[model samples]
Target: MDIRLNQLTMQFEEMTAVDRMTTTINNGELVSLLGPSGCGKSTTLMLLSGLYKPTSGEIFFGDKNVTRLDAEKRKIGMVFQNYALYPHLSVLKNIMFPLRMQKVPKKEARERAIEMAALVRIDHLLKRKPAQLSGGQQQRVAIARALVKKPKLLLLDEPLSNLDARLRLEMREEIRRIQQEVGITAVFVTHDQEEALSISDRVMLMNAGSIQQDSTPQQMYKKPVNEFVASFLGNPPINLMTVERMEARQYKLENSAQMVLLPERLNHERVRVGVRPEDLYLTDKDSGLLSGKVLHIETIGRDTMIRLKIGNTSVRALVDPKHQLQTGDICTLGADRDNIHYFDCDTGERVNVEKEAQGDADTADVEEYA
Candidate 1:
């Protein structure tokens, strides 16, 4: 079931919830619509499910246009944030509800429901009421119900949000496995960056009613389309430093002595230098691009999170726990030439590395670090 949204726009009064969004969700691939709250991810999902008709544009489930289809007419199985199970009905009956409504014979519906329950690993819990099951179990029941009718497409709205940390981890794996086993085209909406990265085959990052970037989780993190995409996807966040080009291959932090030998050629005189926290390491002042005083430290597992104050700006880096450092101690940070990212100051677009004699600037001259 390949889903396509062709210039889909959903406007309500003065607000446009889904701006002319056009993209295709490939058959049997699970993609996640990821963004912050009010970014219109949920609204886009609604448009796809036929819950809201677009103000313009078209939607297709395979080659068939479903732009005017009613919600019930579209074969979309939706698993909501809340389980949305019946309190009085047992799991078996709840899972059979959809098939029953379609006038499926009682015997066939019962068998289908039982098979779905087994698929989601909840077959034994079929006799239990919704209130009798744990949060994870209830979620499994919801997933089973959605699949029992053999929906061509499945939409999960923050399916694991209500679970505990451990349960969330467990279900993330389960969802991916079950989705593969069912071989259905699936789309899930979530604000959790890590969750989207781990679970989906691809992620469509949304912002202000438009798709920002659509790519694999690895590419989205390694090579973000823009600064916002880079910042939004990281946990501690990528460190941003304002820099100005001094000359060829020479860039300096704005109004500071922190100089760097940028590996890429820049068309703009002013640009932003982005370096991930994990890419930096502690080094002597002579070999470092920037120097600062240690302001804060936190130990997360074996990795140590260190915040440094450089002039008026604060920079953060993650290091090994073996490096003993106290507050107020002077420190310097160094990054590999390939790890640094450069973006245009005004447009906020990445510098085109392919346009230049790449790596000519990376040949480290000792004086450049001074």
Candidate 2:
């Protein structure tokens, strides 16, 4: 089902939990609500699932107004971090519970429960109780139960969080596959950026009761709307450097005596440059735009994370594991002009060099990363 939140707001005492949030989620699209704790992501999910009534505004499920609807009457299925399955009930019985609550015929509910169990690949474990299953197995059963009702919408609240790292990956793939096969409108809530990026059709990044950015995972990572979104979405995060324009096409570090020639297209007089760790290439000498001393190196199988100190600023760069580098080594970091991100230091807004030069600085800032 297509879901829309129109000017939604939720308040507790004097604090706003969700502030005038508005967004439309199309049918069959798996959208993720991603952010840190206390960011209102979970609150938004509860509102959509009709578990919490919004302090103001309206919610629509297709053409029906569901803002005041009861949780069970919303035709929404929910799976929580704990799985919430009845320990005494068999997998098949747990899957059939929702159907039975709606007064589905006994024989038909059983058939549908079996079908859903098979869909989530838990049919063979149908007779097992929640206590007899592994974390992943129990989660699969929960998914099966949610799907058994053929709900118009499915809400997942950090469903894979309880599993170990490997199981989290495995279940993420399973969830994506099941969502595709069933084609249900899904809203997945998670604080893990990697998990959301890996499985969501679109991601909604939230902060302090407001939506920060909403876009494809690739876009959100590459072209963040502001410093907060940029720094929050990436592993090792984006490298930030304070800079001042020395002259036309020339810029210098704000805290250092070092200066470098800038690309002709860049026109920001005073700004901060943000470069992804992957975008930086390390060199032996001061031949690049920035020079630093390597402070630490972390080897993680396929990739190496190198930490360097430039003046007083510390930056991390992701390099190949094969690169020979050690602590205390001096290195130069360079980024391709196309990969460099410019943000106004004072406003924390991205600087659009192309638009600034064309005298049209009012264009909407690009927020998604590629």
Best candidate according to TM-score? 1
TM-score of each: 0.93, 0.92
Q: lDDT: which candidate is best?
A: 2
Model 2 Cα lDDT, one tens digit per residue, 138-253: 99999989888889999999999999999999999999999999999999999999999989888999999989988878777766777888889887789888888988878888
Candidate 1 Cα deviation (angstroms), residue 256: 3.3
Clashes of each: 0, 8
Q: Which residue segments of model 1 deviate by more than 4 Å?
A: 354-370
lDDT of 2: 0.87
Tens-digit lDDT track of model 1 for 151-245:
88999988988999999999989988999999999999999999998888888999999998887777677667777787798868899888777
- Compared with the true structure, all predictions reach lDDT values of 0.86, 0.87
- Model 2 bad stretches (over 4 Å): 264-266, 283-287, 321-323, 354-370
Q: For model 1, which pairs clash?
A: none
